[model samples]
Target: MSGQLVRSLLIALATALVAVPLGYFVAPWLGWGVFCLGLGLQLLFHFRNFARLDRWSRHPVVDASLEGEGEWDGVFGRLYRHEKELRQQIAQREQEIAMLIAAGQALTDGVVLLDLEHHILFCNRTAEAQLGLKIEVDRGQSIVNLVRQPEFARYLSDNDFSRPLSLRPERYRERVYAIHVIPYAGSRRLMQIKDVTQEDRLDQTRRDFVANVSHELRTPLTVLAGFLETLQEIELDTEERQRYLQMMSDQAGRMQSIVQDLLTLSSIESAPPPEDEVVDMSRLLDKLRRDAEALSGGRHTVELEIDGKADLLGAEPELVSAFGNLVTNAIRYTPPGGRVRILWNRTPLGAEFAVEDTGPGIDAKHIPRLTERFYRVDRGRSRDSGGTGLGLAIVKHSLGRHQAQLDIRSEVGKGSRFAARFPLHRVIAQG
Candidate 1:
């Protein structure tokens, strides 16, 4: 603005000086008043043009009338238009940036932006919650200082933007996260954290389960096949033949039991959650106890205790299977004179069914993995008891489908307790 004012004042002063001298010398020969008037009008016109140019420069658009009027007018007009278009483009770009920021905020995965210097430039809401970040105070802070994980720091420093780093936050002890850093334009980077803990654990569990099941099945199958081959190759007496056949039959039956339990587990996992319906808890427990006692063949005494009045609302068959498996396991693991108890009781929030046995209890370290398929605390004892190693796995899946939880309490050399708790909402009065 000051520069334009200076140029205008210089032009006005120079024009006046030349005009005054020309008018004084030449006007007397012509008409003095006319020349003076013409010069005055010329000065007024130049002053008006300067004022118009100043006003137009401040505005986004200049008056088109200013064009072609003078050399300076044409130059100023074109410059004004060019600047106006550039401003409009900048406004459009800013809108796009705002939209992208909004989209990033709505994303499920946590997002963080960092500059070339590794300072946090921006973070979305998801990132704020997941990372426990105070964006206002943390902005411009170094990422290495804020995120103290050594693996994450190495991941960023290595510039391995393609692969994500796995991390377990202190807040979610059971979960795992995958963090990815992607290099963006202007030497900036985008860091994304995704929750993949469940998927990863499930994948690992499936792999281990398949391997365990194969091993468990192969052992019995190999034994049965070998025994049959020997029997076919040699001649045996009637008693020896009958004993060999009985052994082979037992091995084959063990394989059959394992396969059956596998199918039951698969069915439970694949099936949808059971619909709510009133079930007679007392009747169910009584029937299961009788069946367990019968299956025990006078070896172990089976007892039933029902203290719950609320009916269970779930798939009856699944519940029966789950409960029956617990009772049978207790009977099988117990000694010939041992006793098994099945109890159903009510609590404030729900109903619980517990199966307790007077058999050797499991170690504390092996309690958590007892529900895993083919995960046995004592492999030899489990196999000798004719366990398929998938009973608890089936129970786990079945209870899960019914929105129930299993609690196992055990101590070595003492007895163990296996209980299933069903939520109050899922329990109804018998109709």
Candidate 2:
């Protein structure tokens, strides 16, 4: 502005210098008239330039065609360059904001921003779903008012954020979330919400597993201890002493079986999937039939049916353990004179190894949890039948390694059928 004014003043001074010299030689007052006319013309030119600047300012867009004339050209050029730079900066900022939003959406956790008054500022899609909020509707609204959770309101009011808050919203009763609020940017706060349902479930499972192990071990250990103490302190007859020893050995064997099953389950869980060795279904079925008959000890009728020429593509030992568990479970559960049938069959999708028994069937509710470690339909009956309870759990893990699925269909008092179906990819045709 100052440069433009000085240049204008210099032009006016030169006009006055030329007018005074030319008009003084013509007349006395003519010099003043000439100077006045020249100054008026200069003012008119300045006014036109100002008018052009005003029109551009109303809708300022950087256009080369809008270049100014004479002294104003430098001013317009600078304005165009400055406007272009400003636009570039704005575009860059917009890109950064877009990337940040994308990253937030991709995250597993939810994010929310709030003002000092706890009014909602911004939130990601995850936050909306987790908190049951709609950003468009909830924005600028008080978070406590919208959430309406007394605990959340209290958490904010207390101003204590050293630990995260665990919440189980009524809307999502089964899910658990951990929310942490951090103060940032002077007065604003950022709330990070993470769904911890799986973590909480895993923690509970670990606790239950430990408790079950302790309980299972304690029963057998107590029996062994009692028997040992009686043998050491009392004078028993030969027959009585032999019976006590036999009972002790039976309890020892039960503990050993439990330990071995636990080890097998742990190995299956920790180790990678075994090599896909061709498992001979014929030989495997023959072995399973013999093991079932021996386990049944003629109490139940054991049968084997091979309906398919398809062998499994999996580690032989894993397949054996998986198939053997089902057969053993069937024989154990079947009553005396009941039938236990082991079958290798082909389905449209692939192949299946199934065990059917004429035992009392499982309840529908218990079917889903049947594969859980130490889960039993009847604890007393299972223990009496010498079941480790980890049999089904081990079977599940082994089948999973072979890319197979276990299906259980049962009805009360009608018996049960347990089938392990292998995907087509895991089935090998025997030539």
Candidate 3:
């Protein structure tokens, strides 16, 4: 027997001994009934205490009374410690959930959570702004009802969480976005939105550039091959041979110009941005104007105007190439005796450079794609003028690297103005 049971038996025996002696003495005076009643009550109390102890043994409580059992107490202690550790782990998990919620709110990308019924469960601040949604009103509302796009409705209705659907949310004008849907947990889902407009534009630009380069090269190669074959096959006088040689040289020069421009564009793009170096706009314009005049054979009048009080800070060679292309295009397209004017000025917004020409101006429809590689308003005119069709493309890239903006304003019959505006930070005080 255990110590508790032994103690209980001893207490019971002592009580019985005292009760028997008292009953023996009192039996004659008070009657046998009274003595028997007292003894029965005492026995009942002892049995009840024993029953309580048996119940406690089956369902043990870890308390002071349970200590000092040697082996048994060690097992009880381990059970108590394991329960405590489990509770602590649960508390840590709750804390992690709170932190994740805080982080999701701080993200710039739009995020939304939905339930199996296709109802909105939660939305982040970015989603509210980007999608024009209010979480308070939209929560528990059908996702299909809120997002009216037919494609998105179908995507949500489908149970597949492996692939996400892309969408351009109508809320943001002139922008595109990609969306991803993932099954969250136990009948829940997560949606993520990312901006991809700039990336898409860049992809299209690269494809067009590759095609243009191939076409430009092929034309020159074909001309050279055909001219060489004719020279080999036919016998001609000295004058005719000289003419053929001159034509070949012209074709070769055109090819050389295209290759050089390609190299310059590639070099500009591959290298890191140039360090800021102060450049005098007046001096650069004077040199460029004289060069343009010479290139035009003095057929077109070249005029220079400087109104800006600020100099420029960037790579001089890149500026030269960008500005020279604009001026050269003017000279090439303008009729003989027509005027080309280059203007430089500083506005409150930034420094502006404009090249205005009396050439046959571009139509309104072609203005958007004028800077595209090999995209010509008049291909025959461009070819006759010996244009590589990469000049405007070079200007566009150079301006982008300098964090500048290019604006073209033109009318069909009137002259055209091609202007570039640089940020105020890039403009320095004239010395």
Candidate 4:
């Protein structure tokens, strides 16, 4: 504004100097005409500058870089500075947005942002993989159309969002997701998807395990109760009373076995891992052999083979229980006079304690679940043999504590070999 005022005064002074000379030497009329022409020229220049500024503003995006002299120059410079400031602000906001998106991508749970119209605005990589969505391709598209699940559609449509919705997305590899819809900004929502398949399976397994335990205990208690009622109410001969007492004793023993095994399992699972130490494998196996022979009472032929001299490094009690359980299982499962062999050997991978039994082997289908508590290939036969179904499960847990694995291989009519293989780190070579 100061520059414009100074320039205008200079033009007027120059015009007046020329006009005064014209009026003194020539004519007053000619001096007046020169003054009017000079003023008209000034107005013309002002209008031209205004037109340039107008044209720049008329476009969708204004170019604030128009070069000019005097007042116009200052005006153009200020506009350019303002436009640059606006651009910088926009760039900074975009950078922040990118950082937020990157953080979301690093999360395990899927995150998605939706507009009021249910159009997908943004989604993280987890969301894309978990929900079968293409982050880039699916933007601006209706989320419901892509999901294609009536339950999911209903979940979205429902206004009550106190809890998350859980359902399997059939379109995407039968994955289970816990979807939480959080409403914000009037009608906009943030949808977060969490994959809960493993969690759900564990919950179901726990429920089944608890139910199985109840059923197992109920049967023995019911048997005992019935026998006690019979003994109290009815009179019987000495032999008959002895038989009834013996039957009750057997039922009581069954319940005791179940309780002991359950306690063992619970203790192993709850206790912290045992401190590692060297264990004499030969001595342990010898003790286990003697126990098996006593349990067998010479009915089954028990054999022990020490292939490689390597003492194991682990909790002695756990190792003893694990190895002894395998050996006892062989003795219990095999028929009278069948051979039950216990082998301690060192392989390239590690040392192994394997028990091979000559009995009715397990079916291929039952091998996978043999370690589950109370799971049996033949329940009636297991009970008849005084075998608690938890024996194999205990073996599994004990070996797991030692960082060992149980490999069971069996064939019908042949035999089954249950091997507890220990890693080299757990094996110390002995002379």
Residue 190, candidate 3: Cα error in Å is 2.3
Instruction: Give a tens-digit lDDT track for model 1, residues 1-431.
Output: 46555765676666666666767777643444555565576667767777776786676453445552445565667776787688789899999999999999999999999998789999999888877788899999997887787887888888767767889877666878899888889699988989897899999998998899889988888988888898989999999999989998898888888888888888888887787766778788779988988989998888888785778889999999999899989988888888899998888888899999988888899999998888888899889988888899899989988889999998877889999998888877543
TM-score to true structure, per model? 0.72, 0.96, 0.69, 0.88
lDDT score of residue 313 within candidate 2: 82
Better of 2 and 4 by lDDT: 2
User: Please, what is the whole-model Cα lDDT of each candidate in the order they appear?
Assistant: 0.84, 0.90, 0.82, 0.88
Candidate 4: misplaced stretches above 4 Å?
Answer: 14-18, 26-76, 115-117, 172-174
Q: RMSDs, each prediction?
A: 6.8, 1.7, 7.1, 3.1
Candidate 4 residue lDDT tens string, 1-431: 88798999999999999998998899999999999899999989999888887887785243645666678888888887777788889899999988987899999999999987789998998998887899779999999999898988887877677989998887655567899988888868999999998998888889989988998889889989999999999999999999989999998999999999899889989879877788998899899899999999999999999998999888888778788888888898899989999899999998889999999999999999999989989988888888778988889999998889999999999999999899989999997
- Model 4 residue 116 lDDT score: 74
In the predicted model 4, the residue pairs found to clash are none
User: Once all C-alphas are superposed, what RMSD does model 2 give against the true structure?
Assistant: 1.7
Rank all candidate structures by their TM-score, best first, as comma-separated numbers: 2, 4, 1, 3
Determine which window of 10 residues in candidate 3 has minimal summed lDDT.
62-71
Instruction: In angstroms, give how far residue 379 of model 4 lies from its true place.
Output: 1.2
Error of 3 at 314 (Å): 2.6
Evaluation by lDDT, superior candidate among 3 and 4: 4
Clashes of each: 0, 0, 0, 0
Question: Can you tell me which runs of candidate 3 are displaced by over 4 Å?
Answer: 1-99, 128-133, 148-164, 169-175, 228-248, 307-311, 346-351, 400-404, 422-431
